[model samples]
Each structure stands twice: as structure tokens, then as C-alpha cells.
Target chain A: MTAPEPAYVAVDWGTSSFRLWLIGRDGDVLAERRSGEGMTTAARTGFAEVLESHLAAVSAPAGLPVLICGMAGAKQGWVEAGYLDTPAALADIPAAAVRIPGAAADIRILPGLAQRDAAAPDVMRGEETQLLGAAAQLGEGDHLVCMPGTHSKWVRLSGGKVAGFSTFMTGELFEAIARNTILSHAIAEAGPISGDNAAFRTAVTRMVANPALATSQLFSVRAGSLIAGLSPVDAKARLSGTLIGLEIAGALSLVAEGTPVALVVSGGLGTLYKDALAAAGISPAVIDADAAVRNGLAAGARALWSL
Target chain B: MTAPEPAYVAVDWGTSSFRLWLIGRDGDVLAERRSGEGMTTAARTGFAEVLESHLAAVSAPAGLPVLICGMAGAKQGWVEAGYLDTPAALADIPAAAVRIPGAAADIRILPGLAQRDAAAPDVMRGEETQLLGAAAQLGEGDHLVCMPGTHSKWVRLSGGKVAGFSTFMTGELFEAIARNTILSHAIAEAGPISGDNAAFRTAVTRMVANPALATSQLFSVRAGSLIAGLSPVDAKARLSGTLIGLEIAGALSLVAEGTPVALVVSGGLGTLYKDALAAAGISPAVIDADAAVRNGLAAGARALWSL
Candidate 1:
């Protein structure tokens, strides 16, 4: 008879989104599900109700093991898994087995990572696991890994551990500046990441070469369009280029110069970075973040089972 | 007769704040008043009521001329002062007087500036006046004027006109990053802006040198505090330095490199720019923004009478 289906589920839950995978005994994903029951909205409907609703569709056995990551393990998550400070390895991740009273599954939440800098102590959730997963795949190399999102992370990986990392509110900054600030009207809703967009490249180079000018440069996007008749689409692209390019230049400085760095980009803006990296004379190894998270969850699950 | 009284009551209204001055024919300040009658909140109480209530304390003639600046002249103001496109001189500023019915005054609002770039068209409101003020002061010089505020403006003054200018959402960016984003807790309420904080200067220089890394470097503030025991105030200062220093570097680029440039800083953060300017090896000719605005109003008023 087929071995009783694996008794565990792995989940990657974040602020505004959630993803889950049903695993069999041998680490096979029997079924996968995604939903809007993210940490932010999970409060309106209780976390248990949200989880039960999503799990109802899955065919996992009663009383299965469920492991979760991301914001779902934060202070406000289904269960708080506390933070594990950095200089951490895979084994350093904390495992908290949370039993949902009268539920069919026992949930284990993974703790996020924290790192102390004598200059500015910092901590992070969710991305630490992704970083761990990426480091595991990369083996050993002095590299700069840029994970672009609402709050982008730039991590330096060396000697099989996270040497140091920094976070930029690049995505959030972009949104606020584009939507909430005065430049909102001049930018288009959407446009090609790269095209006959010389403004984009010029902006990127300008910021990268002279980051100090980033604040003032933003004004030029609107001025160039309004005064010189710059197309709104091109203006938007230029604005994006300026912010992203500045981020790339900033990220590059975290590691040793000429260290043969590889930008392990993971996020929606990964393609943009690939283009930007190319323009800046750097070739990056692009990794699908969703796939990487799945791989990480699987690897994490396997490690939990000591397989 | 008492210098013919003031022809008009000039107002400078802004988001979250408002200020008005009673001016005489000779540009003497008859009286001035300010209130929390900011634009954001004024919507709840009609703009007319706000104006009436604030001016209730001042005794101006019913038919006096009223000139206004700032957000009071925006499209959303009591009456919109349409934008004047750029390559515009002080004389070109549109004077489409806004008439507020049922008021004891003749309101003439000065129009803001708009500029179109063939690639990215944009516009400005109060900043145009600030630029005009800077230009008026410089008289004749190739000047790089840095105006720091919620939205920082770097104007190029050439041939006694606004050659071109750029704006950076640096202050807003800092507020959003520090108060709205994950870095909120990492920063303190306030910090020293003096040279005693070398770490602050270092972080600034680092960011100016490589702006792309801004996102990642933010995490270091937390890490430094948690691991190395950095004081919260110092951490906050470092973050501020990084942002401002980045802006100063960007503002510097509006002029030819190594050119004799004068940085005319007008804002609440003039002292902060003073420190940043010193660090960057530039001399700063600081001006009280309020004083400059008054001077600008006088110039505009004088020009209007002459016309």
C-alpha cells in the first residue's frame, strides 16, 4: 500500500500574502495553495479560521505537522516564534511546535533572524530563510545577494554564512514617492522596464555614479517631462531607474570590491536588476524567488525530518 | 495716510500649516498671523471659514488687495492659481488673482511654475517663489541653491533666472522610512547634528559614495545597536546623516564640478545642511526661509505695483 501520506505541511506566510505546500513522507509536494489570508488580513478573520479554510482544500491526514515561515511567525502571527539573531546558520533557526487546540494539525513556526552591528543592531524575518536557502544552493562564494521587495535586502554571503546584510526601503520608497508625493501626476501607471528609454539608463548611471544627487535627481524626472516634453512613460521609467540604480550601487559596496560578486536577485523586480546589472557591467544570476522559497521550504522540511 | 495702509493681505498657506502677513504699500509688515489652519485639515472646515477666522484678529480694510503664495495657490486651494510653465523669469509668474467671495478683500494669488521635459514633464508651486527669492538675492551668479524641506529643491541660478531646478523627496523619504517602514524603531525621536558624531558623517559619506546600497545599509543601524550597543540617538543621527549627505551630494551635481558654487540653504534644517556642507567642503550661506519668503513677497508686490 502507498505509505501513508506525509504528515506535514510547509508554509511561507508574509504580510499581505500566504503560500502553503502539502508534503509527502519523501518530501514530495502533494498539493500547493495560495491565498490572501496574509498576516495583515489574517486578523480580521482569525488565523486559525484562515488556516482551516485554506487547509480544507488539501488532502493531508488528520493531525499532520505544519511548518511555517515569514510574518506568520512574527509577534502578530498565528504564533510568535521569536527571533534568532544572525551570524546564524541553517541549524540556528528556532522551531516552535504550536498546537492549535482541537485542530487536525500541529504547527511549527520558524523563527526569523536578527543581527547586531556595533554601529546599528538590526533584525529581519522571513528573508533570513530565503537567504539560507540561497546560500545553501550557492555553496561557497563571496557574493552580494539582493532581494528586492517593499523592503529590499542586500546580504553579503561569505564562507557559507551571512557575513553582513542591509535593508533598503526601496520598494516602499518608490511607492510613496510615486503615488503620494508631487511627482505622482507625471509618472505613468505602468511601462516597459527597458525600451527606447535613454532616461532610465541615464538616471541609473547618474545615481550610481553620484548617489548624493538622488534626492534632487527625482525632481528632474518631472521637470524634464514638463519643461522638455518628456513622455510620462519615459519619466516613470527614469524615476524607477534612478531609485533602483541607486539601490544597486549601494548594495555593491557591502562586499569587497572586485570580489567577483554574483547578484542572487529574487523578487518581482529581478528582471529590472538583471538589466541594470548588465548596464553596470555586472552579470547577475537570476533566481525565481517563488521557486527558491519552495526549494527552501522543502530543504527545511527535509532537515527537520533528519532525512 | 499711514503709508496708504496695505493694498493686500498676502498669505502663504501650506499642507499642515498656514501663515499670513498684513502688508502696507511700502512693503512694511503691518501685522502677521498664523494658525493650524493647514490645507489637509481645512477641508473639514471650509477654506472660507478658515480664512475668515484667522483674519478676524487682524483689522484690514474690506477692499484691500490680498496676494497669496504656497499651497494657497495650488489647484486644491481656495482658488487655483494655474501653473506657469518654466524657462520662466520672476516677471512671468502668473498673477491670476483668486477672488474669494464674501471676503473683505481682493485676493490675487500668484501662480506657481510648471516645466515640461521632452522626456519627463513636471511642475512646482511654492518652490518657484523660493527659487525666485534665491535668484533675487544672488542677483547675478552661477549659484546652486539647496532648499531643504519635506521636498528638497536644488535650483540652478544663472543670468538672474531659474536656469533649472530639481527636487528630492528626501525629508519625506526619511519620514516614511523612519516612521512608516521597518526602520522606525531603529531611529530615535531626534539626534545631534554636530561633528561629535563621526559615525554619522561616515555613514553619510558611504551612502554618498554608493547610493544603491541605501536599502541594505539601513539594517546595519539596528544590527550595530543590538550587537555593538550603539546609542539610539547616534543611530538616528547616522541615519539622518546618510539621507541628508546623499541629498547634498546630489544637489552639488546641478552645477559644473569644481565651479565656485554657493549653497543657499533655507529651511528648518539649515543647521543640518551647514554640517553636511562643511563635511562636503562647501561653504553654506544660510538664510532664514521665512525672511526670504517675506523678501520675495515684497519683490513680487513691488513688481505688481510697478506693472
Candidate 2:
């Protein structure tokens, strides 16, 4: 494949992951690099070095403006790009990007979104970019966008404005409970839980029906393994379903009925969440997270440098 | 504390704790022994040896019938005492106790309670004894009993029969989530969560109102700490409240409206749960767990040996 001359560099630097794409003037990907040197690793290894290595690996031209997002903007990251408090507008995000001073290349890290309400103080670093990229597909009107990951974000978007959002530690809690609690014994050797698993669907439905019974349902995983002869795979699936189902139910509780839902996700988690949402009787418009973040970075570039 | 002549020996052999009580024929305490040589330790250091040492410590009469409960009856314990299926009679439990064979002493372990339904399979070993002891205080009629611990059991008792029970992994989940997840950073050096904390009460109220939003509430603890100037104590309290509140909500859902609730708890957890129950709008009849287990063993002995 012949590589097009890179117009600019787009980076999505998350907590534990880093992805960079060289974009052509025509909006086509010229070259790409992905690594585990995200904000956490980059903070220790020097963020500039990590970015420069990835840029060099992609053979990007000198003076190409690099636009970044995610934890790179976190306080402990390369630069504290800070946050744009909610009810902030998406169009105003690029202008808020904090440039890395004294750097050889033109590099800018986009600020995150923060809801500073006393009741639900929340912050999201890299996902604002994804929301920006996927915002066009989501269109106008009321939207409840579900972004599933370590800390899942359920954002309320009206028109082009991010009204507010809630973060659920669904993925992180699942890992902690499964690995550190008695349920670990039940699912220790199990493989990845499939979205199509019957146990998975049932658990999701149950949580949505009576979310108060969530922790009790978690114990039932171990009990089921002991008395009901639940296999390790099914046990694992139940754990996954309960957490994901709780997330869906929580998100649903905040929004108005019949509001359009969009899921910005990639890979296996995408399928799992899709199935979970389906179990909860909602079909969301799906957006590939990879393209969304890249598109978000490109949007930032276009606004910042007219690329 | 005048010591009476030993009529029989009662033992609560739990997972990580061992307690032995010498009871008089008139139901008076004779001598007592407690140790960490519970089923787990005894299973390794020899169950017979552990029992013999405790018996020696109490100076029990040789061949005195010993009544045991909890994990000592599990398959991995000294003897497999099995389980009494629900809706089981409290009177029938003593009859099902498995006597340890080939021992100089007549030692019997009480059977646990099991609900083997496909939907909510559950089991309880030690807490069944607590329920048995607390049943008299609970009196006749429908009762919902909350026994908070490592595996918190919510029992549904109709008259002297146990209809069913559900276990919530509240304590275990709290430890796992606090120590194994990102929230650890928020509550790294925090003290134990108290029932009196406003944060605790507020969390309980929130969960009761909308249990589906439970996991989201968990993330708020971390978010609150990071952005809302939440102290470590409040962070810990919030985490504790979320789990406990979820348990309360789950327990309430299973019982009839306004069923008289009883709390069978012993230590600090008792106070925390009492506050949680109060927050959920229920004033439970509190029963000291220590006395309840001993009474259970005494009741079992009376039924078995007519002591």
C-alpha cells in the first residue's frame, strides 16, 4: 500500500493505552502506531519521548501539527489541559486545547469534560474526543451516549452541548469482584463471557428489573456454582452481565424514555454492551470507537490549523 | 460467672473462627474456649486435635456429647453434615446433624440450610444457627432477618420454618473493591466507615430510591474524592454505604411489605447495618449474634441428647 504524505498527527492517549494516526489532507489514514505507553507509562517514561517515538515510527513529516486527547490532559499527565465544565459545547472544545510549551513539534492536548455538580461530581478525559467524532452520526435532539470501558461514561447530549454525564465503575468493579472476592473461585478458569450467553442476558434482564438485588445476584453466582452446578463460563458470564446490566439500568434511569441512545465502543466490549442494551430493550446506534477518536482528533486539527 | 457441671459441649466451628462452650443441664454456662483454630485452621492442623485441645482447655468431661455448627460440617471439614432443604423446619435441623464417627467423644455437626431452586440457589452454614437462636426472640409470624457479615444472609422465616434466604457479598465486595480497584487511591488510609456518617446515610437513601444506579454511585465515591473535595473518611463511608444500602434494598424486595425485620449481628457491623436499615425506613429488632449461636448449639444439644 502506497502511503500518502501525512498532513497531521492524531493521538488518543488514554490511561493505559496510546494510539496515533497520521491523517492525509483528504481525511484518509496515512500511517498508524498503537502502544501501551499511555498517560500512566508516558508520565514515567517522558510523554514527549513516547509521542516522538510513535511519530518517528509512522515516518510523519516534520512540523505536522499533533492533536491529542484523553489522560494526556490529566493532572499527572504530560500537561494538565484541565476540563471544560458541563454544559459545555463540543464546538468550543478545540479552542480549549493546551499546547505543550518548549516542544519542538506543534503538540496540543484537548481538555476533558467535567460535571462539577455537588451530587454527581464526574470527569472524563479522552472520551470527549470520541463524543465529538461520533456527534455528527448522533445528530441533534436528545441523546444518551453510552461509552463502556474501565470507567463507563453515560453522557446526556442535547444538540451539540454536553448537558451532563454519569460515570459507572462497571468494568473496574467487575474485575475487582471477580478476582478479589469469593466469586473469583467460581469463575477463576473461565474464558471471556460472550454477549450471547443465556446467563449473561438473564442477569442483565434481572438487574434492570430489580437493580436493588444486584449484590445478592452476585452472591447467587457463587451459590449457583455450588448448588446449581453452574459452569465456570456461566459463572463468569453472570458476573459480567450483572455489572453491565447495572450500568445500562443506571444510564436508563437518568434519561427520558424514548430518547435516542448511541454506543461509542470498539471490539469485544462493543458486542457485550450491544447485547446488554438489547436485553434491556434498547437498540443504540453503534459507532466504532477507533474511527470516532481519530475523527475527533481530525476535527480538532481542522479547527486549530485548518488542515 | 459461677461454673456449672458440663452437661454437653457446644461449638461454633466457622471458616476462620472457633468457639467452644460447656453448657450445664439447666442451660447455664460452665466454661468457654475461643480460638482462631476454626474449620480452615483445623482442617490443616487436624480437626480432632483442635477439638481435643479446646476440650482440654475447658476441661470438659470425657465423652461428653459435642454439638458443632458452621463450616465444620462442610465437605472439606471434619464431617459432611449436609444441608436441610427449604422450606425446612427449625426442629428438623437437629435430627439431620452428622455425628463424627470413630472418635472417643460423641461429636455432631449441625446441618446447614440450602435453597436449591434454579433461580436463587443459596446456602448458609453458621448463620442458620444464628437464625435458630434468634427465632424465639423473633416469635411467631412472618419475619425478615438480616444477619450481616462476610456473606450477609437475609432470611425469610414463616413461623418456625425458614422459607428461604438470600446472601449478599457485601463485606467481601467492599474489601475487594477498596483494595483492588482505582478507588483504593481515594480511600487508601481511611478508617472504617461508621453508620453515623452523613455520607453513609445519603448513599443508603440514594440506593433505596434507585438501586439500578448503585454502580454509578460507587464511581461517585472516587469522583467525589477527586473533584468534590471528599475526604478519605467520607469516601470510605460512601463505599460502605453503597454496598450495605444495596443489600438492604435487595432484602426488602423479597419480603412482604412492612415485615418485622430482625438484625442478628455481633460487632461494629451490627451498628452499621442498623443505621442502614433505619435509612431504609425499618427499625429492626436487634439480636446479639454471640448469644444466638450459643443458644442455637444449646437448642441442638437439647434436641439431640435431651440435656
Candidate 3:
């Protein structure tokens, strides 16, 4: 396996995670690095030094221009890269990148997108870049994109521009509820739930049908375990299903009756959400999030420096 | 005020609270004692001893019979009183009460109600007594009773019998999400919100309108704080209104349309829930929970010993 000449560095720096990729001259990945030194950690450990250490570990050439995204551009990050309010153009995002001042090397962090509506104000940092990369594939069309995570982002993109988005605290709420509530005892002995679990699909269907019963349905987890002898795995699946189904229902409410939906996701949650969406009668166009982010960084790099 | 001759002791032993009232022969309260030594505390220190200490504090005479309700009858309580299955008469609750074995005095703990349906199983230990007390005031009707608390219970009482019920994790979820999610920062400096806050009412109305957007509405708490200049108090209010409204909507889904609704509540939450119900366009008949539980205990005691 022979390595190609590295062209630029791409980093997705989030709240508790950091991922870096050294792209080759031909846009092929030469090397990659991942760590827990995200903005939260990098803030205290020095962002520049953290970057340099990873860059050094990957053995990237000196002065390789780097493009970054995510919480690293948040207000509390190394440098505050302010938001580009909606409806923001994907093409214009590259130019809005804020450069690290006084650095010997070129380093630019992309701005997040903010929906400044009086009724539904929202913001997203890392996902805008993913949208940029995935947009080219979506072409000239209107689309509703669901990006599942701790704080899930659902974006409405039209003709290469973002109209607006809603962020649902789906994953965070799931962890908080499952760990902190009385349902914790119900879910304690449960193993990991799969996409094929009947309990998962049933919960999703129930929530989509009557989302008003959200909290009551949650209490049923405790009740079901206590009286009906519901096993723990099924209990956890029901919880995961209820939350994910509600997210899909909420995102679907924002779009039209027949809008095309896409799921931009990676890892295990990809399957979980896919099952949930299917349970909600949706078949989204799937996009690999890893490829999306790398391509987004690549697009930003090409615009800033034609390497 | 001259104290009357005590006949029996009525105790509401909840998860974290203990309230004992000494009832006179004329069905008047001779003395009352309140403490935090509920089931959680008493389980460690001993339930009989805790009762004795409280009884001694009130200077109750020896050989007085005690009627206990709530968690003290749970499986983990001092003695497992078991449950009286739904559709059972509320008047029959006292006869089902389990007397503690080998006790000097006649100590009987009331049974809770259990809805054992596969679709919506639920149980309540303490609130059943509240229902028994509140039931007489709501005589001869098919009614939807809303008892709001940590685990809010909504009961369908048809002709003085609990037909079915649902439990909503409203208060617990409110505390968990506020303290554990990203919205925690949004609500960090928030002062306690009131029932009359416009933001609270607005949120309740919005949730009742579109219950599907429950999690998204929660995110707005953070978004509003970040971009829309929402004050911390308003943020907290919005967070609260959303949960309470969802509970109301979920509870409403279970019963028939236009069923007469009643709110049996105690403490500060009484005002807050009344405001929420009003926001949801509900003018429920209000019943004081404190009075309801006492009356329920008195009814049970009268049935058991003919005092």
C-alpha cells in the first residue's frame, strides 16, 4: 500500500470528539486521526497545539492548509467563527471561513448556520459542511435531510441553499431519560437493541400515530416492566423507538406533505434511525456521514486553495 | 382549642414524605404530624420505628389502630399490601388492605390500583387513596381525573370504579431534561416560573396544538435563549409548559371526548397545572389533594373498624 502526497488537512471538531483526515493531491485520504480532544478538551489544552500534535502524528508536510468545522467554531472555541444566518448558500459557506490569526500555517474554521426566527430560533455548526458535500449529490431540488446524533439536526435544503433547520435533542434526551428516570430500572439489564426488534418498530408506529402520548408512553416502560413482565431489551428498544419516532414526526411536520427526505448518518445510530424512519413510513436517501464531511472539507479546501 | 379524643391514625406514607393525622371519634383531626421520613428513608431506618417516632411526637395514645397508604404498602415497603386490580370498586380498597403481621396495634396498609393491560399497564400506590377521597366529591359520573405530580396519573373513573388509567412522566422528565441536556445551560440562571407567565401559557398552547413537536419545542428553549434574547425565566417556563401540556394531551387521548375532567392536586403545582389546563382550554373541576387524601383515609378507617 503506497501513500499519495498529502494536499490538505480536514478536521471535524465537535463537543467531545475530534477527527482529522490528511487528503491527498487527488482527494484520496493519505492518513486519518481521531481523538476525544474536541473543542471542549481542545479549549483547555490549546487548540493550535492539539492540531499540531495530530498533524505531526499523521506526518503531514509543513504548512499544509487545514479546514475545520463543528463546535471548534462555537463561541467558546479557539476562535469564534460566527454563524451565517439562513437562508444560507452552501457555496458561500467556504468564503465565510474565519482564519486563525498570526498562525505560521493557514487554518480556517467554517461558520455554522443559524435560523433566527422569532418562534423557532435554532443553530447548527458541523452539519452545514455535511450538507454542502451531500448537496452536490442531491442536485437542483428541495430536500428534507435528517442527521441523527446527540443533538439531531433536520435541514431543509432547496437549490443548493439551506432554507431552515430544527435541532431535536433526541439522543441527549434518550440518555438522560433512560439513565435518570424510573425507567432506568426497567432498562438496567437490557442488552443492545437491534433495528429488527419488534418493540422498537411498535413504539415508533405508536408515537407517529399519536405523538401526544409521548411521556405517557415513557411511563408505560416502567409499568410494562412491572406488571406485564416486559424484558429489559424490549424496554430499551421501546424507549429508543419512541424518541426516534418523535424526532421523525417533528421533522416531517416542518416539510410539505410529500417532500423527499434523506438520512445523512454513520455508525450504529444509522441503523436505529433507519428502522425508526421505516417504522414511520419513510424511505430516506442514505448518505455516508464520514464521506460527506471529508468531501465537504475537500470542497472548502478547493475553494480556498486550488491544490 | 381543646383536643378531641383520638380514635384512629391516618397516614399518607409517600416515596419521600410522611403525613400522619390523628382523627377523633367525631371524625375531626385531633393532631397532625408531617415529616420527610417516607418509604425511602423509613426503609433504611425501619418503617414501624419511624411511625412510632411520629406517633410519639404527636403524643398519640398506645393501642390506637393505624391506617397507612402509599409506598409503605409497596413491595419494598414495610409490608407488601399488593394491588386491587382496576374495575374494582374504590369502596372495596379498605377491605383489601394488608395488616402487618405480628404487630401489637392494628396496623393496616391500603392496596394500590394496577391496570394490567398489555398496551398501557400502570400502577399507583398513594394516589389511589387520593382518588378514594376525591371520588365522593365527584359522585356518580364518568369522569377523567388528573392527579399531577412526579408521576402524573390520569384515571377514568366510571360509576365510582377505576376503569383504567395512564401515568405520564411529566415532572420527572422536566427535572431530568432541564438539568441534564444542553438546555440546562439555557435554564441555568432561571428563577422559578409562575402560573401566569405569558411564555408558559404560550408554550402550553403550542404543545396542545402540535404535540408531535414536543422535542423541537424543547430545543426552542435553548434556541430562544441563544438567539432570540429569551430570558432564563422564560426559558424555564417554556420547558415546563411543553412537558405539562404534553401530559395533558396524552391523558386526554385515553378518555372519551367531552368527559368531565377534574384536577386533584396539592402544593405549588396546583396553580401551575391550573394555568396549564386553562392554556389547553380546559376548565377542570378542582379538588384539594390534601383534603382528598385525608377523607379517603377516613373512609377506609370507617369501613375497617366502624369508628
lDDT of 2 at B66: 94
The residue-level lDDT of candidate 3 at B264 comes to 98
| Model 3 DockQ (Cα-based) | 0.82
Instruction: Sort the candidates on TM-score, descending order.
Output: 2, 3, 1
Error of 3 at A217 (Å): 1.1
Which residue pairs clash in candidate 3?
Answer: none
> Which ranges in model 3 have alpha carbons more than 4 Å from their true place?
A1-3, B1-3
lDDT of 2 by residue, A144-198 (tens): 9999999999999998999999999988888888888889889988988899999
**Can you give the lDDT of residue A100 in candidate 3?**
96
Pairwise lDDT winner, candidates 2 and 3:
3
Clashing pairs in 2: A70-A126
Local accuracy of candidate 3 as per-residue lDDT tens digits, A184-240: 999997888998999999999888888999898899999899888989999999899
Positional deviation of residue B220's Cα in model 2 after best superposition, in angstroms: 0.9
Index of the highest-TM-score prediction: 2
DockQ, prediction 1: 0.45
lDDT of 1 by residue, B131-208 (tens): 656566666767777777877777676676666666777787777667755556656665545644776677777665
Ranking by DockQ: 2, 3, 1
Query: What is the C-alpha lDDT profile of model 3 across B1-307, one tens digit per residue?
Result: 8767899999999999999999999999888999999999999999989999989998999989999999999988999999999887899999999999988999999999999887778899989999999998999889999999999999999999999988999999999999888889989978889989998998898888888889988998988888789998999999999999988888888788899999999889999999999988889999999999999999999999999
Q: Lowest lDDT 10-mer window, candidate 2 chain B?
A: B1-10
Q: Encode model 2's per-residue lDDT on B275-303: one tens digit a residue.
A: 99888899999999999999988888888
Q: Is candidate 1 or candidate 3 better by TM-score?
A: 3
Select the stronger candidate by TM-score from 2 and 3: 2
